[model samples]
Target chain A: MATIKEVAELAGVTPTTVSNVLRDRGRVGTATRERVLNAVAAKGYRPNLNARALVERRAPTLALMLGCITNPFYPEFTLQTNNAARRHGRFLLVCNTDYEPDGGSGFLAEVAGSLSDGVLVANTGSLQVDELKSIQATGTPVVISVWEFPDVDPGIPCVAFDSHKAGYIATDHLLDLGHSRIGALVGSEKNGIHGGRYKGFCDALRARKVKHLKTDARFGTDSYQGGFDAALDLLTSTPDLTAIFVSNDLPALGALNAAASLGFNVPEDLSIVGITNIELTSQSRPALTTVAIPTAEMAEKSVDLLIKLASNDPDAPAMVRTADPVLIKRASTAAPKSRATK
Target chain B: MATIKEVAELAGVTPTTVSNVLRDRGRVGTATRERVLNAVAAKGYRPNLNARALVERRAPTLALMLGCITNPFYPEFTLQTNNAARRHGRFLLVCNTDYEPDGGSGFLAEVAGSLSDGVLVANTGSLQVDELKSIQATGTPVVISVWEFPDVDPGIPCVAFDSHKAGYIATDHLLDLGHSRIGALVGSEKNGIHGGRYKGFCDALRARKVKHLKTDARFGTDSYQGGFDAALDLLTSTPDLTAIFVSNDLPALGALNAAASLGFNVPEDLSIVGITNIELTSQSRPALTTVAIPTAEMAEKSVDLLIKLASNDPDAPAMVRTADPVLIKRASTAAPKSRATK
Candidate 1:
């Protein structure tokens, strides 16, 4: 906790000279710089970042507002953003909006442009565009880190990935495996947050001229239990289906387990695929076949853009489109038994 | 981005009066306070928390240094701590040390006493006690949020849960089911971070007069793949074991899948028990029967203790012991087939 004054006093130099030596700025004699360095090392002088932030008119951290921390995907996104921020010599201030009563409006009001230089909103589905814009109006840069739909701009700065492509890849993989009877498990309403992915599923089926009946799809909450119950109900009602396409990974893992519980040998009796190849997809029993969304790329790009916007860089894009989702074929999908028998 | 001076000028008051009215301090007439408030709302002035922190010499955030954010346990722990910090009107600055080249020594040196008011170290195993003490010596409060061993103090302010009891409860659950032929899977070295839990398992076995063979145990990394590989090996070698006690939930989950892969029906062929009932344990098929550690209680206590220490409260205890670990009986355990037939 040695102050700059103490170090300056010990080094027999002015406080500004000590600051110059520490920040590697301004001209100081080599001997004077050495003296300041020795004094800093001897006294264990660490510069106060908050004090420096005030002097520079820049906060030392970026605030990342996430809806739910325990949702599995957010942790991965947060970790990537945290590392990306650190690489830029900044710390990440994580604001979990799920715990906030007003869903983080209070937090945004308090910290925007004051305690934090920029804000990154991860769960854009739960946040309003006007709220983010209002914070942006206060001159704190706000970037939507995970906009699921790239085709429709959210009217705020965002990093978007092709959710429709992710769904298409997952469904097309099952179709390529020669499965005509495929069920869809949407993690939200038909036109909710996961609408793009659901649309892709329908498009992929239509492209192949496969008839997707009304009873072939079930919509529910976007969670493990949601996937489990929906899959259980779907499979029980439509027992002849050869494959299932789930909108999200959490529920897909649930479908995987639910398939096991119902004595349906995965990829043999029934094929299953999910979008967003989260870490759990690979670790599951059958090693889920999922379409890998560019989670890390989107996270890093979002942080980079937020930092640029905060610095008033003219080159910062309003919407950054990341790499397309790719198919990650694993043990969960295979050719239908009818084809195998032929 | 409106300044306090602008609000003061519009309200027809001195800057000091405006400040006092805004902070609700000093004597001010009701009419004057109303004028100041109206002007503040009209001007959209938000206080710069960094400047206020500088004036008060108190940072507005607490730093939580965790090893891995993606780990199921850490997210749960981080969420609880985030919620607790929010309740105190302080933001949570999460530092993921696993990505740090110096393993967070540099992050600690930079933010400990400057940017964050206090540091809460969640992953205590990899961090050195001397490093934590050094930060504490610099006038920043450092609290170990998840000290596994309560009997042995880590020489820093900490919140500890009974890791030993957590192990005991998990092992005792298996013993109660008449599974004498039990194997052990330690997620760390036999005498490493999970030693307390491993010891509890041994004690539980000894209490029941059940002999535990050295060959019936395996030690490995505390991850899903680690548990999967180790359990696959353990079950292959010690096929007679009717039950297994895993030191941690993540590894236990791996073991559950490993057993399933090996064609063993959980609770029927092999009753498995794990410590720390993470969210995944309940979501897994048939669910995992594990000991539930007081994760939230420990997190809240740690944040409270750190806040108290930051305020230099004399009543702050050196070490706080949280509520004992309890057994959460799920679907993962049952009586051995031998005992059931008898």
Candidate 2:
């Protein structure tokens, strides 16, 4: 067994240089790097990485959990968050929760002891409180995005979109377009954020003195297919409805397809407003009207939150950061056509 | 210092139970688990993760490097590969190169000495050879997906699609549809696989005795916006071409949008064929006719290869596994109609 000093002496470098090269910290010239590596091998220098890691109290990584990677909106979110993580000199461990109860739990169990310093649940309504607690008990900090635990206080930080405000804006836009009859495409109860969005939708209608129809609100998974099915269900059950406000953009695209299939022209026969404003919204046949949740800004803010959680006072009061949502007027919304002659 | 035997004695469990709890291995009874944890904490037992990791000769993690995470094609790839990795009890560390030279180098440098057991470069045309070599020298196995070093062999394993065959198939599809004037959209040269695909494009035209007009082929980055600009350039410069074959789906999508903005109806006015039938292809305004590279199959195969490289044989000969591509006929392509009389 040899010491760091011995390896450095043999490699013709200072102990600090050898340590830095071993840690891969500072810039070491290629030649110097090779010499240090060779000397480390020759000297059988095996540093206790676990001991070092315990002392450092960080893993230079962050865990990001999303609903599903294939959902176009998530790809944008992932790229931005990953870029932000890299800029902060950290790597991102992305987990696809598939919005399943088991998906989040199984992944948490898998990474129990070996997790990075902090976790960022980038998607809303994916993780249950118990699942999050399992992760939190491991001593890794958790910062949730978009959705918060409604019933249980998980005692963690959060970055959220003003979902209720977005919902009101979307509904109000349709209302201004002379659409008195509106339908809601809401996700399941599992998604905590949808509660606020749905509430806002109802509140907007109440404010306008419009009666709320239970049949107008359809709940399902957060997917394009889900949105498509919800739209079909709503259109068939509530024939008088002239507008629909979808919770997210992926399903909103599905609703657009549904409208096309149902022999109705978007904006002319039916108006659609969605949230998230993903890239495809602009390129869709009718071009979707959406509420833009600035994913890049959210990712940046969430990364900043994770850094603070990892480095600052561990007992600091949990902070909730809110990102404003903007309404992007596109080709999809308009006043419904006058009723056909009876 | 507390030994495993001492901790187990106080917890009323076997020493193996204490060790398993410390290693975060196979499940133990809840009561036993709690007792073991409490005893370890009370007795101040600290197992060395470095010693365990060294003895295991691997970490239960994989490094997956992609050109960009925002590309819709990669989200599908990442999800499938990540699922496969999870099933095998390994997690993935995702790295986004962003098609920049420094991005890959900085990441490789950052993760030095603390790398996962295996690496998967999931995108092509992004990183240079030196960047890959720097990662390879870390003593962890490297497996490049859909890209390889052209000038310098990085002496690593690879999984690639037959891009040449895919190019020929896409071009041949257009030729069989009675189109003589066809244009091509080639991605950047930095993507190692593009060269083969481009060569195949030329060879197909040559086989058909179509004149190899230098103006017919165009190169650009493999992105929707990149494809958009390239299509705009080609459509503006070449007025008589009936169809275009794009090397990737992202750019092909751009081509679709560009054609729409230029007032050309897809399939009816300008038949377009793309590669990598991404999830959005089927849902696009005109369903895209694409060369479907079985990304899921590729991911599964690559994961298996990585497992082997990480375990069974560190010294095994570097192997290249090729996945075949298929042509998916969709609404975006059709026979060119004879010109309407002015």
DockQ of each: 0.76, 0.34
lDDT of 1 by residue, B200-247 (tens): 999999999999999999987489989889999999998999999999
* Model 2 residue B5 CA deviation in Å: 5.4
- What CAPRI-style quality would you assign to candidate 1? medium
lDDT string, candidate 1, A71-165, tens digits: 99989989999989998888999989987888788788787858899999998655688888999988889999999888787888899999998
Top model number, TM-score: 1
Candidate closest to the true structure, highest DockQ: 1
Q: Count the backbone clashes (under 3 Å) in each candidate.
A: 0, 2
Give the number of colliding residue pairs in candidate 2: 2
Please estimate how well model 1 matches the true structure, expressed as its whole-model Cα lDDT. Answer: 0.90
- Residue B316, model 1: lDDT of 96
Alpha-carbon RMSD, each predicted model: 2.3, 5.4
Worst 10-residue lDDT window for candidate 2 chain A reads: A145-154
lDDT of 2 by residue, B1-342 (tens): 457788999999998889888667888988889999999878756553334555676655688888787778788999989888887867788888873457575565444345467778786344666666655665666777654223334466766567778888888898888888888888866244577777777789889998757797787657788888999899989968889989888889889889988989988889899887888888776779998877887788788887877675765446554567788999988888774322
